[model samples]
Structures are given as structure tokens and as C-alpha cells.
Target: MQVELNSVWQVNGVDGLEKALYRVLQLYMKQRVVILFPLSDSKALLRPVKIDFDNFSEAIKVGNARPSRYDLPYYQLQYDDEISREHLTKRDEKYTLIVDLVSNPDFLLSFVERPRSKLVSLHAKTHNTYVQNIYRALNLYWKYAQERNALLPGYKNSGGRGKARVAGEIKRGSPIQLSSSSIEAPKGVNTSESDKELFIKAMKKFGLRGEEVKFSRVYDKMLKEYYAEELISAEAESREAKVPNYRAFIYWVKKLIPTDTLIRKQTNQGDFDRNKRGLRGAATDHTEGPGSCFELDATVLDVHIVSDFQRNHVLGRPTVYCVVDKESRMIVGLHVSLEYASWRAGRQALINSFTSKKEYCAQFDIEIEESEWPCSHIPLRLLCDRGEFICKDAENLAVPLIGHLSIAPPYRAELKGIVEHRFNILNEKLVHELPGTTKGKQYDRSVKDPRLDATFTLREITKLLIDEVLEHNSSIFQDLAKQSILLIESGLSPTPLNYWNQHVKAQRHALSKADEVHVRSRLLPTTKVTMTGKGIRLNDQMYFESDHPDFDAWKIIARNNGSWSLDALVDHDNSSLLYVRLEEEGSFIKCYLKKESANFANRHQADILFFKDWVKLEKNKAKPSAKSIERHNRKKQVIESAIEDTKLEPKVGSKSKRTKGMKARRREAILAQRLEESGAKPDQEYSSVNSEQSSQRIDDDRKKVISILKRKKVTDNET
Candidate 1:
């Protein structure tokens, strides 16, 4: 090995490949790397090492082959120092020198001639003089080839090695002696121009990435066919018969095509685009404090949960929303719902996140101190997928939090590791243990119908989730972040709750009592309503009205004709009372149903539309238990009852005085219409006119009458 001549060079950034800005880094930094080490297909062992200044290798800086990234391969450079490992230079006795030849054009040209492989592969393949001469020529190519200016002026002396025709004496069928200065060229396979075209076309087709049969496989199949072999074999310019083969084709492909270009042809755009974008952000992105980054995500619960109001009403897979702190990886809040992943689901989760966990836990009979779940704070940023993250419900909640909301790329769940991992843990521990667990893709749990195995109601499972989350928050956690340059500054503790207790609680933004109440009231799922003199109507049948201070303010706004449209944030589980936003006072009014007295208190908890339909169906029944009604059967009964209620039984004999003479009037009108349609005008007809036109009109009217009577007679017969 030879080292480069000494030259003074100043160190600079790995050329502005900053990794901090893309991810949330309020408190910590982490980096992940994968490198294709030279001379090996395996990944390199990436680490910082002590190296002698004289032994340091100035890594080859090549122009980027990627069209999208015209800049240097900054990511690949992260592992450039791996080649400078001590063992790479040391042979036990002393350190060996590393060479740098990127600036030498002459060396690059010689390198292209495959000097290393030639030097390593020299062996006698055939007995004889010419073959031995070919070996000597290649041996000479391995050395003294880099001194191009002296030996290959005008690049002519390179011809001696290029054609291996030293002194132009080695020829076909010539029994030449093998000597140091006289050598023959290696045998070159010949192919017809037509076969060359066919080879190129096949290469183009095989270059594209896919799951289909590969180029080598196709070549093997083609070689087995007699007709294909005949088409490829042709007389070359040297009068030698030649054919296209897989090995020669592969060699050409590697010689002509760049690696990325070949990969791009084989795979789709998504593969390269993802690779170039880099899967995870640099560790610096999460250097901020705990409250700075909150990850929100929704996933279907593994276990089945039945409706709260109806025990046996299995709601299938309820969507579960989770909010977690990126810094601590602590689950801050969660919501389990009978609905799908909608804006409402996101709002429910946000409400839980901003509320006091002590009070929230008490609702489920779990005791916890405010200090235990002190994660309540407005995040500087909320990271989520496009699902509910971009919905209006999330937007409304974000307004108060004053945080930046980012949508993670669909494939990058690694960005939201905090919430995503929590969901994984929740399923592994809580949901999988339940009787009706789907247990993911294994199919064993779901094969027998998980719905049939469902034993927990929504309310019961909700309490279970509360208990699980509380346990998770209090449990000790371990930090498994990779060792990196970023980890040197701050030592992140393993326990999320302890870290929150020690530092994040003091630094996080806390919601005031008023702000908490406002957020709690605002984050409930909302439906549009109109503020009318009668009241606010929702779910088609329920009307909300009240004398609450908020309602009074709403009435004032409605009276002033302030646009007329209003929104009601209703509790999905309990539909009795609804909250209306009063922007006038920056407060909410709790409105009770106008017909609350007519329905059972339990009906208030049911979904308004479903409940109202049930109320009408069971209006006169002595027992109106929600559990007794199968959801489908209840819907069927409700629809049938509704139809019956809306049905009008026409009176027999003397319908109503209002409709008494309607039949006779209709009869007369029908007759006049028939006569007028037959070219008879009221203003000119119905008089005793003896004119010829009058007589023609009378005859036409008679014909129309006869036709209409015949049709009516047939209808009557059919009836």
C-alpha cells in the first residue's frame, strides 16, 4: 500500500447532511446506519476509532449517480471511517499505509482493466505457448500500467496491453513461445450484431425489478431451446461461430450499467424514494423536553367489546387512540371507542390527554395521584398519521394546544415509536389475554369466531384499559436507544414516570382549571345543529334546549341572527345532555333534551337516533330494556313501527268533507282533459254549432272517448 503525498486540507462538515430537523428532538438524539462495505456484501461495523494521521484514507468522493440527490451521498459517508479500522492497516508488527488515488486519472484507467482480479486469478487454464503469453501480458498490466504518460504517450502503448499484441506477432494458429515482452491477447468471444441487439433487449427487460423470473433463469430456459440457440449463434467477423450466453451478458451489464440504475429498473419508484428520504430522522430532532413532542395514533383493539347499554351487543373491533410523549415514551392518554377511527375518536383521545388523570382514573375506580400521570401538557408538536390527525376535530383541539401537527409518512411508523410501541404492548398484554381476542394474524384465535367468544362489554373493557394504562405509566421502562454521537451530551433515564416527576413536570405547560374545562367540553365529538326559537335539534328526533347560562348566551346570539349555524359536542355514550360552544363568552352551555321527561333515564345514555327509534318502538311497552333488543332486530322493529305510525287510514263511506267532492271534481276534470286533448277547446266547444269544423271536432272527441273507454275497460277487467 502507498500513501498520498502530504497536502494541507481543512476539515468541514460531512457537507451539510444535518439530521436533526426532520424528527421531534425535544430531549434526545439517535441515529441508525446501514453500510455496504467495500469488497463485501455484508454491513460494516460502524464505530469511532483511533487512527494514525499518516495512515488515514481520504475516502473516494464520487459524483452521485442518483438523479434525485445530486449532492454527495452524505448518508453513505457516515460509515466511510469504517475502512480506517486498525486491523485493516495492522499486520500485528506495525501499521500499514492506506492509499488514495481518486485524483489520478491514469490510475483510474488502469483500475478499470481489473488489475486486482487479474493479479489474484492468474492460473494455468490451458497447456501452451499462446495461453502462457496471454497470462504474461495480463501480469504486465497489473504493474507499471499507472505510469501512462511515459509508456503510453498518445495512449498508443496501452494498445500493447489492450490487444495483448506485443510487437504484433501473436496470431491465430501460431505456436509462439511464451516470453516476458512478447504476449498474446486473451481470447475474446465473438457475437453477430443481430444477436448483440437481442442480448441488449433482453438485458433491458431483465433490469427491471420484480418478483418474476430473473434474467439468468430466462437465459437458462432459452439455452435449452434448439431454435433459440440457433438464432443466437452466427458466424463472426473472424469466421468463428458465436452465441449470446448468460455469463457474457451479465459481465456486459455490470460493465455498462450503474448499480442504482439497474436497481431502479428492477424495482418501483417507491423503493428508491424511500431509501433516499431516509427512514428515520437524526437524533437531534428529539432534543427538546418531554412535552414538546406528542405522538397520536389509532389502532383497532385486538379484543371484542360490546356496547355499554347492551351487554350482548358485540361492537366488533373498537378503535383505540393513544397519545404518548416522545421524550419519555410514556403513554399520556388513551381512548377506547365502539366507533371506527374518526374525528370523534381522535377528539376523545385528546380530551383524555388534556384532562387530569387522577379524576379520569377515578371515573373507572382506579386510584392514582396527579403526580403519577403528570403528562398532561400542550405539546409543541403533535405527530400522527393522516387518519384523524388532519380531521376537523383534531384541528379544533390543536387550536387551543397551539402545537404544530405533522402527518407521518404511511410506511414510517418508526417516527411515532412512542405511541406505536405502546399500542403493540397493549395488545400483547391486555387485549390478547381477553377471551374474544383476535390475537393478530395467527388466525387461531379468530378461526372459531372471536365475536362468539366476546364476554366483555365496552364499559368493562374501558375500565380495564384505564387500569392497564395506569400500570404502564407507573412501571419502570428501559432505554434501548442506540449508542451515537448525540447520546453523549444527555443521559436519558429508563423510567418515564420518574423522569416526568423529576424534570418534565416542572418544564411542561400545564392547563389551567378554566382551560381544562374548556378543552374537556370542546373535544367531545360534535354534530351540526341550527339554533331556532323551538330549540337545537340533533339526530333527527332529539331537540336540545335549556336555561343554562351557556344556552342563554346562545339564545342571545341566535336572536341577533348571528349566522344561525351552531355545533353541539355530544357525549357519544351518553346522548342526554349536549354542550354548545358560546364563542360570545368563550364558554359552553349544557343543554338537556326537550322531551327528557317522556323517556327513561337510560334512553339518555343510548345513541339518540337508535334510542329515539327504540323509544318509539317500545313506546307503550312496560319493559324497555336496551339489553333485551338485538341491534338488528331493534332496528327492524323501529323501522316497522315508524312506518305504522306514519301510515294514514283513509276513512270509509264519507272520507272527510274536505275530500267529499274531490272524486266528482276529478272525474269532471279528467273528462275535460280528454276532450281538450282531442283538439276540442273549451272556448270554442260545448255549443250547438252546425259548421263543418265543429262536426269534425265532435267526431274526433268521440273517437278519443271510445279509445279511453276501451283501455279503462281492460284495466277494470284485470283488476
Candidate 2:
């Protein structure tokens, strides 16, 4: 049989096999072998001895020799390099020193050949060491496997790690010392089962609730309730109670309750689930490559920004929406506006992500190549929180634009951690350093007002953010956990832009090109507009007109019949234009604000809504005015006076008398009323001149005036 050298072999079914096993230590060239009784207590059996190889084989054949299933002795195995001498404790150092001396080949050979006691004495004399040290080393080397780790002191196993001490009458710790004779020394008490029960009761009442309570308070309550008699007696005697101390109570509490269980019991469910839960996976694990998935989230910027129209007016914090590619960690799109975190503001961010960045940056006077920020494609999936995307309006995006929409569970923000983490980066790196940042604690911010120090307008901050995003895209990311083989072979740095470009070049990206107009139309918020005779009315105030061939006919029909309503999509940022859907499957027609709604033109939907609210408020404020009350009172008086006048007038006796000479009476009454209005007498006569008589009179008057003027002109010429 082939046997490995320096390996232990067990001989089963031997004479003493039941009591102990024998190990084959070495094979000699003279057909002999050395056998060691490794587990023997007799010193003679512990020593190695040579036996006839033929006899050993016959014995093994009957006993069934096999490799040793148990671990080998210390001298047979290699030493561990990780066991450093400098880090070993004092006990371990002593063991290591003995192991080092015995590990020498000369010492091992001498140990196997000579008597152990005599060998130890010789080694001690030769090395000028203690005899007991050599003997201890010899015993330890034979007992454990010949490895450095076997020499390590068993300090970890020495102490009772988790065992609880039984309470006794006397304390099991150091005695208390007193500095003054008048003051009494504290007699510490061991925690009994009853005392532990009290501690558990106190924790359950105070510490195990959603509202957090201090351990000191809990201990105080326990002393007041459970140890009331002991406390009173101790206070009367000017001494402490002979009960378990606060430290023992805390220890028992920890021993009874686990840390995670305590946390779950002492905090609100929402807080625990959101802030204290463990993260099992990463956002990038779900993403395929760049543009495979995008995370969208909105946050109110910490710094207050001024209005774009008026620099001095602080518009408070602006809500900024960011769209980040999960795999590349690139901020693909952004939208900063005064609008709150809603669908209206969120859709703008989606639009920006679907449109080119070159044109978007040009609006802010930033010129850049398309390659610098080339993230204009729609992703395969979109992930967002439940705030904005959990609505019917968001369906427009899912049905037409992107492949799938993922709404994160409520109170779990880690699912969209990519965009959420980007918001933190923006705040910490840029926003916190701005002039009007509310980044400090409430007490720290009491010295000055951040709002008053506001310096950046919305447009200016947006431009700065655009630049920041570009810089971020180009910056090196150190925490990339995974890289593809192609990326590694290319030896490219881990930057968002580089990753994105490489993936796109390799056609590994899930990016999809979409028409900008179609994206905008689908992303805009939809509402119903009424087609009326005047124009198409929105929100019963703003009006729009369409140039489609059917628009005129629809208007005419609306005028003759009742007004009809059609589904229209409106851009909340601009109230000047709208997209009206006339048919179910047809494309949306572009509509502009009509002249009738000119007051609302070139204004935002929010501004128009605010104006309408202000008008309503003003009307409400003027409803109960003094002038209105007086006008109503005067109207009542006029009706009463007219009623009295009609009562005083004589009544007609028959219908025939009332209808007699209707036309003549009407003409007389009209002429009389005209004469009265002209301030003429009641008996004044009116004459009507014929056209022929009027012409004859005009000719006579013209001849008389011509003769007078000719005489005057002749006299002037003679003078």
C-alpha cells in the first residue's frame, strides 16, 4: 500500500484498539517501521519503537490498517505563517518559545531517540534554559498537530463567555472603598431571579414602546415601584439599597433582549423599515447597461433661490427633478422649477431626458458638443417613488414612451437609491456651499437667515447645475464593483461618460430613440377643453383656436347646439399653446390661445390659476360692500314708487277702448315727448318742408349772399 510520508496511519483491530489506537510514524529500509501510541498515558507506550515490517504487515492485515481519521500530532504538520509572534499574548509567547526550540530537526531527532526526561535535561543544559520548559514543549508538541496555531493560548475558551453567575448572599466582585468615615461604602448586590423579573417588567413598560425612554428613567421607575420599601429604608438610614445596581440591571436587559429586537420594539414601523433596514442588493444589479433603467426623483433644493423675473424676490427652495442612469451612474436629465414635486414638474424632467442635451444647454448660454452630454434616449424601464408616478397621468409615459414603469414601495426609498444618492451628492458638494443654504441644524442657523442671503436666480442655479452634472459625469467613480471583460481589456477609467460611451459603441446599451414631439405630446398633462362659439375654452377661462379643416364646422355646430368638449394636453410651463385631440386615434392638433383669452397668453398655468384665485378672492371681499347695499335699497325704492304711480292712474274699462287709435296715439305721444325733450311749449306747432320748396329758398339765399360778397370785394380792391 502507498502511504504518504510524515502522515499518521491507524491500525484497527489491534490488541489494544478498543482502549487506544497505534500510529505508524516511519518506515525503515531494513523492513522495519516505527509505531507510536499517540493517545497512550503510559510513558513507555508514548515513546516511539521499531517493529518488524513483516510482523507489522501481518498485524495490520488482521487489524485492517488505514489512514488516521483523527488529526495528526504537532510535529507532523506545517507551521502557520499568519501567527505573528509580536501579536501573541504572554501565555501564547511562552508556548511559542517552547514550540520554536522543539521544532528544530536536531531536537526532534534527539527527542524521538532518547528518553524524554533526559533529552529535556540535555536540551536545557545546552540551551541554558529551564528543564520544565523543554518538558512542557515536548508534551505539547506530541499532544497537538505540529503547527503554529496549535501553540496559541486558549484565552478565548478560558472565560465563561455567555454563562450567567448564580446570585449569592455575598457579592462576587471587589469590595467597595470609602474615603470618609461618615460616608457609607456601597454594598453591591448580585442580580437575583426576582430582581431580573423586575428589570424585565420595567423594560417592557418603558423601553419596549414606540416612544423612546431613557434607561435611567426606566431604572428610576423600577426602583419606585418594585423597590419602594428598600428605597425608603435606605434613604432613612442614609445608605443605598442592598439590591442589584444599575449596571447589573442593564446587563440583564441586554442578555434578555437582542439588539435588533430592541430596535424594532422601540421605534415606529415606518422609521424602522425605511432607515434601519438592511440593504440586501444594489440598484445596479437590476440594470443591464447604460439606458437600461433610469431612476427619477425630486427634492426641494436646500438653498433658497431668487425669482428669474425679479432678482430681489426670494422664491424659496426650488424643487429639482433628476433622472439618473442606474448602470452608468450618470445624471442624464434635470428639471429645476418653482413647481412642487408633482406630475407636471416630473414630466418636464422626463422630456429633458428624451430630448437632446445640446439644445437644452444652449438655452442657458452653454455651448457643448453632443458627445459631452449625449444622454437623450429613453430607457427601457423607469423607476420612481410613489409620489408622482403613481397616478393616471403617468400612464401616458408607460403606454407610449418607455417600456416599463416601476413605482417604489411606500416608505422604501432604497429601491431608487441611485437618484436619491445623486440628490445627496448635489446637496453636499454644491448646494451646501452656496450663499443661501439651509444646511445647518436649527440652533446653528439661528445666527443668520439664509433666505436674506439668497443670490442665485432659478435660471442661474439651473445653469450651474448643468455644469455640475457635466463635471460629475466626467469625474472618476471609485466604487464600481463590477466591470465587463471588454471594459477591462480596454483599460478605461471608471467614469459615467466613459462607461456610457463604451456601452453604446459596443451596442450593449438599451437606449431607444424617440421623436421629441411625440414624447412631449405624451408627457404633457391632459385636460378637457370646451369647443364654444367664441373659441375652445380651457378651465372655463383660457381659450384656444385650431386651424384644422373641421374646426370651423365644429364651432358652428357648437354655436347652434351646445358646446362640446375634447381631450387636450397642456404644457403647464407655457399657457400659450395646447394639443387638442379631435379624434380617438388621430394625432393631436396644435392649438394656440385665441384673442379672447389674450390676457392669459404668454403666462404659465400656475400664474393663470393664481390670477383666477385672486380675482375670486377680490370678488368675495367686495360682496358685502356699503355701495352695493345702497344700490339694492335704491332699486327697491324705485320699484315701490312706480307701483304707487300706476295705482294712481285711471284704469281702462274695456279692451276696445284701450286698443282704439293705437297708431295715431303712438305718433302723438312720440311727437309730444320730443317737444317736451326740446323744452318747447305744449301748444307748439311743427311744420314739414318739401324738398322742392327747400331748394327754391336755398337758391334765393345763395344769390343774396353772392351780391353782398361781390360788393365787399370791389370796395376792398378800390381801396
Tens-digit per-residue lDDT, 441-495, candidate 2? 4426547888889999776788889999999898888655265555566788888
**Candidate 1: tens digits of C-alpha lDDT, residues 1-719:** 22222211122222322211111001101212211101111223221112222222222122211111112222222342553344333321110010122233233233333445442123222222243333333222222121111111122234464342222333333233457656663443444445445555565654454423476865654444423544445423443234544556565556556666666666555545544334456432654556667788889888876654566777687778899877766788887776678776777777778777886666556787888777566767778888776767667666556457888887666667668779888888788999889887545653698888888866577788888887787676645233121222345444666655544435443223336657756567566877755577665566778775566666666667753767677766445656876454556777777774334222323334445655687776767456656776888999999888767655465558657788658856865886778877754544423254468778989888743444444566677
Against the hidden true structure, what lDDT does model 1 obtain? Answer: 0.55
TM-score of 1: 0.49
Clashes of each: 19, 6
Best by lDDT: 2
Q: How far is 497's C-alpha from truth in model 2 (Å)?
A: 2.9
| RMSD of each predicted structure | 26.4, 11.8
- TM-scores, in order shown? 0.49, 0.62
Q: Once superposed on the true structure, which residue ranges of model 1 sit more than 4 Å away at CA?
A: 1-284, 391-397, 409-412, 442-446, 480-493, 505-514, 525-568, 573-586, 589-719
In model 1, the Cα lDDT at residue 182 comes to 60
Cα distance off (Å), candidate 2, residue 371: 3.1
